[model samples]
Target: MIPGYPKETFFVPDGIYLLSHSVGCLPVSTEKHLSDSFFRPWANSGGHAWTNWLDNINAFTQALAQLFNSNAQNFCPQVNLSSALTKILFSLPTPTHRNKVVFSARDFPSIGTVLQKYCKTLELEPVMIPQDRNLADPQTWSDFLDEEVSIALITHVVSNTGQKLPIRDIVQLCRDRTITSIVDIAQSAGIIPVDLSHWQADFVIGSCVKWLCGGPGAGYLWVSDNNIHECQPDDIGWFSHKDPMSLTMNNFEYAPDARRFTGGTPSVIPFTLATESIKLMHSAGIEHIHSHNKKLLSRLASQLNVNSPCQPNERGGTFVVSFSNNQKALQTLTSAGVHCDLRSEGLRLSPHLYNSASDIDTLAELINPLLGKRR
Candidate 1:
């Protein structure tokens, strides 16, 4: 725990606790926020809820917008990024003749799975760009750009490889070919800078539970204004209406914003907790937090590069780091109290802003010998 912050009053001390990208640890502030919301839900519910909800939500969205250098109006609260993605993907207007969606093999399964099911139902194609060693080469992506590509979904940072994709360039590529670009920012959200407005991306899906330090079940979706008119979600609920409880029968008006993506009553407790977590991140300053995270990743990589299976050039830039398949080494480190995770072929260390240099040193001390033994 850093000085002055004093651990924010709540955190579990067991385990190495360096998996913010996977699931962030809730700060004490969030604990308080949820507790307060629980004890006074009626006081915090309805128009009063919307009033306070919108206030906190707007603040949360504004902070995220600033992080992405986007307009606050373009940001809307949702259950999570996956729900948002489903809303947008399912709501797209039927394309003329070409109905295929294109994305990379490296993208998270959720993106592809949703598109695949949607395409099957629509009698369209799902074109997945092939990967070379789990890396989606830009040329392959460009080559897939054609009349058949109605939507091009990609991730800003791969959850598995931690590789950061050139989302801006991909956006431009999609626009030139008239393919809608959807980017999943879950793994990259707070740890890196993303200017969705500047990038001109059509849709951005992300979660608050990752680098943002929010607890589980909290996420957000950013939709470009132009794309809103193209979406007519079939799963629209009463909350999606412009005036959900207007007491008028047979009158439905969808919100002229991204709020249309959110469904029925949300998990308010998690949302409240998430809001507090964002406030904490904002108070710390996102840029400072990002810098701190980068420094930690840099140090971790430096320590692991010694006789490691993967080369420096192959490393990804986020909090997660991947090494070529080394389960034995991973098990060795895990058993040593240096908490790290592995996926398929790599060991990932996703440290948050709260972690310190001493943490990195501790992790290195345990893993170095393990790698040496492997050699």
Candidate 2:
């Protein structure tokens, strides 16, 4: 751990805030960054603003690339995960004969909705594979990738069920079948260390607002060097062009890197906050954050297993846990100031590095009364 940088403390209110999986709480440092950046005269002033703004954007992109284990040439900043994915998906070149994209049904609605909209307009097929609830069985994905798959879009960790899919295996499978693979790293980016070189994904998209604790609008998209040529730039912007000063009227030429994925002027202030957040993560070391987050969830699971209204899945350690309680018990948790959400079968709680054992104790005490007879 770096000296002089104290571990951040989060104000999660009296109620349980287990919804870090949905949207993370802002780091107190990020609030300070935002406040400081907002008061800068150059940010709100009319002159020389573009220079300051663009410089900040460049720095943020470099920081994000370092976090993702890629070169700055391989990354682009975006408003959010959905916006980044939309630009990348729409940019894939349409083959004269082949026009299909393969993905799992477990993907978030953001990816599903946009793909559906594009399929209707382009007359292409959006192939969704069967999502088996049992993630332990690797054959589930193996069997899905057995057919004629063009593009494989997958989530690193499922939000609804807290299942960690076999991303590397799936990416390799796609490679064998000449398919493009896109990875959604929203739930796993900062929580777990990622190496795109080993994962070998064609494209990856994620948001800093969740596990990274960088506040809203801090998101990114990464394009692999090989597949960078496979996607077209549908949503063009001057920022994406190779020469911003060139007054070529009739031609639109994009940079030969991930900058081709960026659309317009991104929110610069958010980028500064994001860079600071990444620096904090780097200082603590990603492996340390991973261990810390897992420890918090493991403790929470232990508390629930001993006295809560559900059984604990001990192996699931992605900073997210779900308590198997009825609708009434779910409401009780919420009414008590636990800020969690209900998924299909349970109430979800995802604690980040800022969460402490006392937080777990507080949650356990409130939820103990809701348990039933356990065999």
Candidate 3:
């Protein structure tokens, strides 16, 4: 059992919850925290509540800062990852000599969709590294960062396969080539250790819905100090102004930091809820959580027909167990009160701090018969 992480801390369901990769279980403190931080102030003071609500937003950034080991000023609260990417894509100046945008086909579908939709309008060439190639190899990424590549979108962890990319190496490669690197930490943020300052990527984006135990709509964007000055975000509003309170007519100046990416009136509730979860994770300690997850993954790997990378360092928290016919097994697991997800690759099972060894054993018992002999 992992110390300092009691299962009672979160709202565990009647059955096992192995879907932390999709959406994390809600923390027990979420409701009370939201009521105290958000609802009460709005009900009591109305417009005057902006002061407290804004403070909550700052608190949210502070929580992320603590998690990522970066300054709170670097983060801009976004509605979701796709929206954040859209703003960044629109903000960057159209490349003159460099026109290629590089990404992997194994990346989340939404990222590819966003890139495809904007590449034509931005006059950029979309170069996708096919799935057949070994994505884990740094050489594969290095080969793609040619002279014409202006931006490279690197996924810290492949969502479907649970393959952890060598982000530090990839980011450094992009830096050396003068390519703007955007690291997507949606799958790695809460489960793996992420240091924004250490990455030194041009931009980083993620959401709190998964693994964070923070509900949806709480996505974020972090810009490196070296790159913030160069961004000119087209998606701007009153909040994007250096002084949002200064009601000067027709004179709009971008905020000197990452806040320039925050468009219009910011959504307060999501950040408020996310702040509680982020702080909770910070208090529990990322290293401890990571260690616990690895132990559980090892147990699962030994018992299941695992398809993800064998080394703990080479994969994220989730494990993908391959099966010839997954539909029947999926139904049986679902009926037996065992929760996990099925993807094109295989059955994806992601355990969290709340889960126990027995849960893993139970999962294996239910699915082992269906999997037949272990290869």
* Residues 86-136, model 2: lDDT tens digits: 888789886445577666676787888877777777777887866544443
> What number of clashing residue pairs does each candidate have, in the order they appear?
0, 6, 0
**Tens digit of lDDT per residue, candidate 1, span 76-153?**
677777677788888888777777788778788877788788788888888887766443456667777787788888
Root-mean-square deviation per candidate: 3.1, 3.3, 1.3
* Candidate 1 residue pairs in clash (backbone atoms < 3 Å): none
Give Cα-based local distance difference scores for all models.
0.71, 0.70, 0.89
Q: Rank the candidates by lDDT, best first.
A: 3, 1, 2
lDDT of 3 by residue, 1-375 (tens): 568679999998989899999999899999999999999999999999999999999999989999999999999999999999999988988889998999989999999889877798877899999988777789999899999999999999898889898899999999899999999999988889999878889899999999999999999999988888889999899899998888377889999999999878888999999999999898888888888888888887788665464366688989887776777778878899988889978878999999999999998888778788434
In candidate 2 the C-alpha lDDT for residue 308 amounts to 23
The TM-score of predicted model 2 comes to 0.88
**Stretches of candidate 2 above 4 Å error?**
1-15, 35-45, 96-99, 133-136, 306-325, 373-375
